[model samples]
Target: MELGIFLLAAQFEAGDQGAVLTAALDAGCAAEVAGFGEAWIAEHHFVPYGVCPSAVTFAAMLLGRTDRLRVGTAISVLPNTHPVLLGEQTALLDQLSHGRFTLGIGRGGPWVDLEVFGGGLERYEEEGWAESVDLLMRWLTRRRVAADGPQYHFREVPVVPRPLTRPHPPVIVACTTPASAALAARQGLPMLLGMHADDTEKAEMIRTYDAAARACGRDPRGVPHAAAAVALVADSRTEAVRELRTALPKWLGLGLPAHQTLDGHPRTMRDPRTYTDYLCSIHPIGTPKECIARLRRTAEATGITRQLLFVEGAGTRERTLENIHRLGKEVLPHLQAD
Candidate 1:
């Protein structure tokens, strides 16, 4: 199994935006030094859900700082951005990073991003999102492209300065729903599963995805899907459990934003206690031995070989750094050996 760092770029009470951004990059650098294989950055807008609005730009910035750790957009919110522009920028990044970039695309959230980015959710839901993905895949892989879907119409245009990585860098999808999982399976793309689901739920979802892939005549075993969970490795189980219990609630609160949309649409409210139970049930948050057990259990249940750890959010930079280091030194090797 391989471990990767999942950065949320969360803003806490300190609210030092500069320091927070710097710490996020520093954490990636630290993860690279700690021997992580990949670093995934998430994109969000108009809220503290995620401060990094441009994941591709952030991936480029991280590439400049680290040498070997492959950087990826955990998702680049396809519905919110233009396919051509995203393709161009991603192709450039692929060249600049020496084919060390991965493109993880997803439909925009139901939150404020669609409205704020000038397209309504209805259009994206109808056809816009799928069309954007199709156009992006064509732009990255083919020389000349023509897209005349319901939501997008374009003549045959060359994807100038084509991606250095043949067939383009690995394109993963953030599969949130069963439909999205099936779509990814049909496309033969890997998926990034969120941390919200329990082990049983995740395993069932993966089974559904694999079955769908097989139904579409694709080899399900070849698809590499990653399951994410908030991880905090500590010296002792007691210490880790205490810290996680306290931070989990705070993190859940941040996941659901406090503010409303322009027309007064409220964020999805979550009870911390309920969310905490769901989180702890799936996450590996304990001593090295305990964490390893949880990770192994998850792998066994879901048949997922890669686990992305959410190491930063609602904690001191120092605390987050320690968690990263512990995960690398203590938790990673055992899992790798297995």
Candidate 2:
């Protein structure tokens, strides 16, 4: 199993943006020293949920700072940006980082981000997403590409610099729903399952993805799908749960409610307290032994070998780093032994 950190760079309080960003970078650097294999950065706009607006920019900086740790965008929202520009950046990053970059793309929410970025609501819709992914894959895989899709129409252009990773730096789709999973499967790409869903839910998604891939005449068994989960290692399960319960809900409360819809379509955010409790019940938030057990079970159930741990759920630099170190020193080795 491969273990990595998911850097949300979330701001728990107002006017702490610098501190939050610095801490997230520090955590990325610490991951390398702590023996983790990769670090994934999250991107958000106009919200404290994730202060880093550009996951690719953040990833480039982190890639420069680390030698071994593979850096990826937890997702660079596909609808908000041009696939060509993103493709160019990802290719450059892949070459510059010596093939240590993964481009994870997703259809972001119907947030005001689409409005701000000029993507409009249609880009957030299914047709737009499918077109974007198709164009993106062509940009990554071929030397020269042209697009005549409804969302994007462009003349043929050469893929400059090209990608250091053969067939392009691995592109993973961030799948939150079965439709998203099926879409990724059609392209024969792996899925990056989110933390909000539990083992059973994730397993169902894997089944969905696998069936879809097989239907499309693509083998799913060799694909290394990833699963994200909140991880906190402490002396006891009680202590871990208590700390996360206190810190995570506050962060979630301030962050989740900040998302505004572009269209007047009603958007209902999850209840922070209930959601926190649910994550705690499903994830590895306990002693090293307990954490290992939970992660192992998740892997066994989902057949997912790549795991991204959202270690910053403790909501502070000190505690987050502590959790990362504990995970690297204690939990990681045991899981890797399997």
Candidate 3:
């Protein structure tokens, strides 16, 4: 029942932009103070919908503001970013945070985020994604790399500073599809999954991951596993959905070619506002009590070790913060280890 924040602005009406950013950051600090285990940021571009696209920067900002909360990116668009630079930025943050930073990666299947870079969903097929991730790992860990690929090329070069955490900080991947989860298992990274989906599907994904890890000659217990899903919590279900609707237009509007789009997932600002409605079909939204209950069910059914909460521009700032704090205090306790 670890708590994590997803950077989004679904509730522009709750307050002025400055206040909203403060609320989000404050929530992170509060979550840490409340004994929540970790906090994460997201990367999005080409629209005012997501102001914090540089998650590495955001993580750095939060490190000094809180103690003990493991900060990380919900996912960094790896294809468009230079792996060496990505490693350097996150590692530096890790050092600054006293080894409290982790890395999250998502090759978003949505089109809007995908088109920003030359690579797209097709590049993630079969050997494509595995190869790309493999290269990324090599660049992150090796002092000198001499590698070439269909999408990237590099000569002998060592990325500096490395990471304060030994063997690099823990890596998490967003894995929903069966194949994708299996891929994560193969790579031995934890995963993030949607909260509203059937637990049966999520369990199947975990099974696939276990099998993949076994095939890779690694013990399944040696790896960490996690799932991240979108959520907006409040005191009542009605209030939760009420706040969620505020950002629907922006979420629905995503789907455009932008400089930071990495995954093919629809963009929040590039397309018509109707796109947010489309996204609602996938995320988990409800009051604190109800959301907590549902999350517990997910944990029991899927056996997911951690739940990544993506609370972004989707709901009013006040309500979003309230739910986050309440969730840490009241909700998480219900989902704790027996």
**Number of backbone-clashing residue pairs for each candidate, in the order shown:** 0, 0, 24
Query: What is the lDDT, from 0 to 100, of the residue 151 in candidate 2?
Result: 83
Clashes of 1: 0
lDDT of 3 by residue, 225-248 (tens): 676666766566565565556655
Model 2, residue 225: C-alpha shift (Å): 0.4
Q: Encode model 2's per-residue lDDT on 1-338: one tens digit a residue.
A: 99999999988777868888989999999999999999999999998888999999999999999999999998999999999899999999999999999999999899999989999877789888898898888889899999887788888989897888886788999999899999999998999999989898999999999999999999888798999999999999999999989998998988888888887676788999999999999999899999999998998998998899999988789998999899999999988888
Residue-wise lDDT of candidate 1 within 1-338, one digit each (tens)? 99999998877554677787888889989999998999989888876666888999899999999999999998898888888888999999999999999988888567666777876675467356666777788888888888787767878888788899987878898887888888788778888888877788788888889889999999887578888888888877667767766776675576566544545666667797677666766688778888899999899888897988989733678988888888899999988888
List ranges where model 2 is wrong by over 4 Å. Answer: none
As for candidate 2, its clashing pairs are none
- Name the top lDDT candidate: 2
Assess candidate 1 and give its TM-score to the true structure.
0.94
TM-score of each: 0.94, 0.98, 0.80
Q: Cα miss at 266, model 3 (Å)?
A: 9.6
Cα RMSD of all models vs. native, in order, equals 1.8, 0.9, 4.4
lDDT accuracy of residue 214 in candidate 2: 91
